[model samples]
Target: MAFEGGERGTTDERLTARLRTGVGERLGTSDEHDTLVGVLFCLPNLVAFSIFLLGPVLYAFYISFHEWNILANEGTWIGIQNYVAVLQPAPWANDWAPLTDPTANTFWYSLKTTVVYAIGTVPLQIYGGLAVALMLDKRVRGKKVYRAAFFMPMMLSGAASAVMWRWFLAADGIINSLLPSFLEHNWAGDPGTALMGVMLMAVWGGIGGNMIFFLAGLQNIPEELYEAARIDGATGWHRFRHVTWPNLGNTNFFVIVMAIISAFQVFGIALVFSQGGPYYATTTTVLLVYQRAFEEGAMGYGAAMAFLLFCLIFAFSYYQYKNRDQAEVGY
Candidate 1:
């Protein structure tokens, strides 16, 4: 009986060894094979990225250093002349004041507008989204319906939303009609209010998407933390300050970063709303890039502006990423 048991044990061990060897061979359990598989899986995305994004970016960079003729489909090498032209103040300006100088460089004016737009819209989008998200996160009736309604604006294309807002802010449109006669004015057509009108549209359209992001982050936070805070007799505001706000650090960081980037890149609404009108009051950097590249046919100058914009965005994003530890929440 002992001999039989020993034989059976030997057979079982041999079977297990064979099975392991067979599986390993079938799976190609080698470092080189695994790397090859990973490469294959990534090939499609790499190809698309190269063709669609990398190629154009390289071409634009090449164009930025030249006098590019769109009609000729060629360029004359100028070696940063385009960048200089974009950066240099106007020859007529007596002082370095781009903001107040009537003859200041268009690039500077456009850059200022872009900065103003970012400042005006980014904070509103962040805080408004957070406020709405907090309200929606509660145990309220029709929560899903309200969430869907809030997010509906985000589903519309930028151009479409801009067109709708243009009508809404027109001289005789719904906004003016609702306002008191003294307060009512031509929102989009007036120089003083054109950019503000565009900002209003941007904030309205943007808050919903940011709200969704904040909502997702709120849902991901563990409930036990809240329960513990409640057990400690923490008030609603205290619980939010101690638990919710801290936990939402990453979400806040992400929302702020994206909001700033979007604000800097604002074009479609400004373009469609006022066409950068009322004496270029709403001419953002990107809109100016378009006017230079397509309308005025200064492709190289436009490319230089675009390159600068890219650098600015990269610098900001990099700074945020480098300081990401500050934005992260610890349990």
Candidate 2:
């Protein structure tokens, strides 16, 4: 009986070794198989990005050096003439002051308008979002409803939002009705108020999205930190200053960068709301690009401007990313 038991134990040990060997063989090949699967999964997205985004960007760069006629679907090599035309003053200009003689340089005028729009909208959007986020973060009745209401505007398409705002700011619209007779004016028509009208629409439509971002940042703050602050006899303001704000550094950086980029590329609101305006007051760089490219059939020149705009955006984004430590919160 002892001899039989020893033989059975040896057989079981052999089976276990075989099982281990099988598992090892399967594990050795699994990594390569998983990598192949991952590549297959990502293949479609890579192809789509190449075709839709990367392809056009490269093509635009090529077109920028040529005199491309959109109607003819052809181009003639012009070297840097398109860029020179965009930068040089108009033939009729008496001086080189682009800012003072904005009309003498279409690119400068549009760039100034774009900068003004950015200045007008970026801060208000960021702070207003933070404020709304704070208010909604509190324990209050109907918080979800308020959140939905605020976020609803963000879900609207840019064209839809522009159309809606255009009506609201019309001569006989709701906004005008609220004002006294003498104070009321054509918000989208008058040159003085046209850009302001666009800015107002931009801020209103933008705040809700920014608020959502701020709310997410606010919620991510650890509760333990707040409790600790309170235990240390910290007031609400003190807690926010030292704990809350510091912890929200990453969120703040993201919000600020996105806001600046969005401001620089603003097009739909200015296009649909003011139509780039009364006396070109709202003619932003992007709008000018569109007008030059399609409307006026200066495709190459427009491509040059578009490439410059891309470079400008890249420079700004790079600067912010390089200075990220300045915005970081040390915990």
Candidate 3:
């Protein structure tokens, strides 16, 4: 301590520095105490995330490194062997065939189907959602009720929705009943229509929630921004292009990512409706992983498939991040 400053003064300076930060000054009545309290409050959530999320992911990776069969209680240390089997899917042992075998399997076909489903579902969902949200954002009669009605499907349990749609898409269901009584026959039973039917069910169930999100984002946009654009002789399309659309970039990113992930991860619908199809056509990566782990009792293979899925999601998300910025600039 300097002689000019007593020990107490130095300690007070340290406390003041700790409490007063750039953005968290509002956290405390006085600057000094706020900082410490705010930091202490944040600690619990950080710790919980580490324990629950990060810990499990790390553990799963560790498990993937081993050859584990939960039912037989047999596993050996085989570094990367599971991953190899999962990707290769070549000819396997007597007990393992190409389709069922985790290793040396042609999972690429399933991956292709998943891509098709995602591509088919996402644009329809996003566009349909935006249309409803636009109408809801307007001054319509019973608008709140209409919004709630639209959002109801999202509140329905995913598995329950799948079951309900399974009946709806089957041969003798409502859709077929309305079909010219000729064309509407057995949609889900036919391989050609089965995958499309699943895609339609997913989009139908998912659109409303994204509509609410888009509506909120649209509503948050300043009315004056539109008014200003109008004053500058901007047409409706031009106004949206210059003002409303650019303002909604973040919400668009959020909706797109959520929709894409949901499309890619679809399993319950396939489980309830097609059951991997007329023949493995609708077997998504998630369903494949589930079967390998639980149904077929290939824990090692399942873990590897799960890892590959993680990689796919990570790649898609990264792609979106890259493209979203470009979209914003173009907007």
Candidate 4:
């Protein structure tokens, strides 16, 4: 019995040693070293993202529950009052009919304006971009120059573009100079035309980048498909409808989602041109947040509004992702 016990102990010790060897071989190899090196390389980006992006977001969320004022440099605990104020109808607005008081109802009015702005700009940007991309895809002389000209507006800083458009869209600016006398009016100074002016600038600024995406999509389509369509006597319109549009489903989806998000977050154009408007016509959520935070010194309120806008953008993106996935599956 003593001999047998000693033998069992020896076997157990050998097994333990083998297990340790296996673990060491797995964790202390060149692959492990490579992993370690990769982690070290990623550390700086992780740290930078945490410090510059995630940290600020978390801090803003924390401050959203407090009444924060930049001038005071201190915050008082408000316990979601800012959020409540942002969500609820304004005191001067009709509680049962908030839309009736655009001037006083801050959140709803801004949301409405944002939706309108998105509607006004996104489709035009997409269609205009697609049109330009299709034209550029053809064998044309000086194609590079045409592409550069179209893309020039996007290269300019948003502030610079805004400033330039402001000058051009002024009552007596270049646009008015060419228009008939009956059509001329204060483009940026009138509420009815202000949002349209902003939309025009947005469409012009965004088209070039969006066109690049479409051009890439166009290039990816197999040329043989077009040849087949031509052999079947398909017209240009039919070819675009059946061949091009079908192939560009993913690209179209991406452009639409991006355009919606960008339009929702529009600020610089409104800032330099309309300043939220002659009557808050071009006031986007971001513009409203800027006004609340910097212009009004209501940091907490601004943060709350920003969080809400983030939620909206997140929801839209998620919805689009789900729809796109389902669509791809169907296709």
Candidate 5:
């Protein structure tokens, strides 16, 4: 009986030791198991974004508060001087002679121009696109051909399309040639017409793309909704009012957001056609940034302009999103 009891004690000790060893083995490898998977999952993307997108964005912000040629001059940190130079609402601030010196007023003018561009172009794109989309939503004859024609400008590269538009708006070009000699004027070289020309071109470039999105949204509205509306004596306009507009909430939101963003960063077309020309009549904030940094080699100041534009766009986008979300919730 005593030997049996001693044997039982040894057995219990051995079982406990084995259990501890097993648990310890798992615990030792547990960190490796978790960490290995994490590294494997996130390693590639983390490195890529840090090197490419995130790195440049961070670097741009750092460059914003400095005075430097940046690349060749090795920037000096002037702190908020750059911001002050940009946000001041003084009349004499736009003296762009000191290309390196971005005054608060010059920045304000650029901001004003950007706001005007956004206000003008976004509504044109959104409303015009929606109208075109409504026109094209039916089973009309040769609809595909009409759709392709409308979308052609959007399909072309911005530089190429802008060049085409510039030529068309130039004196003695297609637009003026079609008109009588009395009406002929160099649209791209006249301050009165240059900005308007650019805005028209922008609507042409953007409306089709917005229309495509709206078309998709229209198609997504369940046909049964329209059928139900018609049964309730909701004829043509009424059907559209009850079934179409309300159903288009999401599409309208997308188009407005995209249009505003595109309008704010409208640089490529400006570069190709206007170059902010006709005596700075068409110079946008982004174009001004390019002129400062790359053209004038005031890289630090140019980076500052870019940062300011980014902040404006961020604020605008946030406002639009919040407003749209509230509207949808109200619906």
Candidate 6:
């Protein structure tokens, strides 16, 4: 019996070794070799991310603490002066507030412009997108063609779209031709109308893409809810309020967050519309950053301003996320 047990133990040991070899052969690697192969596969993407994305982000933050001269490719250590200069509402404070004084800082003024631009455009995009999407959700004639027409502008490159809109909004363009003589002021030139023109372009250009998203969300909502609401004598608006709107919470949240982020990062419109102004009226944060970093060669200040804009976007997004989650939980 003892001799038989010893032979069985040896056989079992041989079987375990064979299984290990079989696995290694099938995978073309041992366990340690497999780990090395996995790492090798990931290495290229890691290297590219570090080089193209991560490196620049970290470098920007580092440069934000210094005085950077892109022309000289040099950065002097300036501590937090760039941040202070960008963030401080008043460059010189005391008895007189810059708000009422003529010597108000351009940085603060541009920041306020950016805030207003964001506030104006985001809601327009959200509500306009929803309205169009709801209309399109019904079985309308020429649905595909209409959808394509609306979405075409979103597919165009920013420069191309801006150029197209510039022509349309030109002094003697189609829009002016269609409008009455008294109403046809220089849309992109007058400070009073420049920002409004850009905002209108932004809303029109953005709505189609957002509408598609909302359309998808609307389709995903169960039809039974609408049917049940109808059975209970709910009116069109009542059905929409209780069923459609509630079901669209997630979609609304996504659209709102993206809209806010895009609005805050507006540069192309401001650049092409008024070139950041008919007296700096349409200058956005991104346009200001571009002017500072590239045109003015104040890289540090631009980086600081860019970072501040990022913070504002992040905070708003966080607030939206928290509220969305709470609403979902309550529901």
- Please give each candidate's TM-score: 0.88, 0.86, 0.82, 0.83, 0.80, 0.81
lDDT of each: 0.88, 0.87, 0.80, 0.87, 0.80, 0.83
Q: Residue 33 CA error for candidate 2 (Å)? A: 6.3
Please write out the lDDT profile of model 6 over residues 82-111, one tens digit for every residue.
988885667356343432332366666676
Candidate that would win on lDDT: 1
Clashes (candidate 2): 0
Candidate closest to the true structure, highest TM-score: 1
Q: What's the lDDT of the predicted structure labeled candidate 6?
A: 0.83
Alpha-carbon RMSD, each predicted model:
8.5, 10.0, 8.8, 11.1, 13.1, 10.2
Q: lDDT at 291 for candidate 3?
A: 80
Per model, state how many residue pairs clash: 0, 0, 6, 0, 4, 0
Mind giving the per-residue lDDT tens digits that candidate 2 earns over 192-231?
8888988888898889999999999999887888898899
Please give the range of 10 consecutive residues that has the lowest summed lDDT in model 1.
94-103
- Report the lDDT tens digits of candidate 1 across residue range 1-331: 1244468789989999888778879886865777898999999999999999999999999999989899999989999999988888753464657765424788887888889899999999989999999999999999999999989999998889888988988899899999999988888889888889889989999899999999999998889889988999999999999889888888887898999999999998888878888899899999999999999999999999999998999999999988876744544
Q: Which of the two candidates, 2 or 5, achieves a greater TM-score against the reference?
A: 2
Per-residue alpha-carbon lDDT of candidate 3 for residues 55-144, written as tens digits (9 for 90 to 100)? 988877777888886876678889998888776644444444654432335565577678899999999999899889988888999998
Off by over 4 Å in 1: 1-26, 90-94, 326-331
Task: Order the candidate numbers by lDDT, best to worst.
Answer: 1, 2, 4, 6, 3, 5
Ranking by TM-score: 1, 2, 4, 3, 6, 5
Name the candidate, 4 or 5, with the larger lDDT value: 4
In angstroms, how far off is 211's CA in candidate 4?
0.5
What ranges in model 3 sit over 4 Å off? 1-36, 72-74, 89-106, 326-331
Q: Which consecutive 10 residues in model 5 have the weakest lDDT in total?
A: 96-105
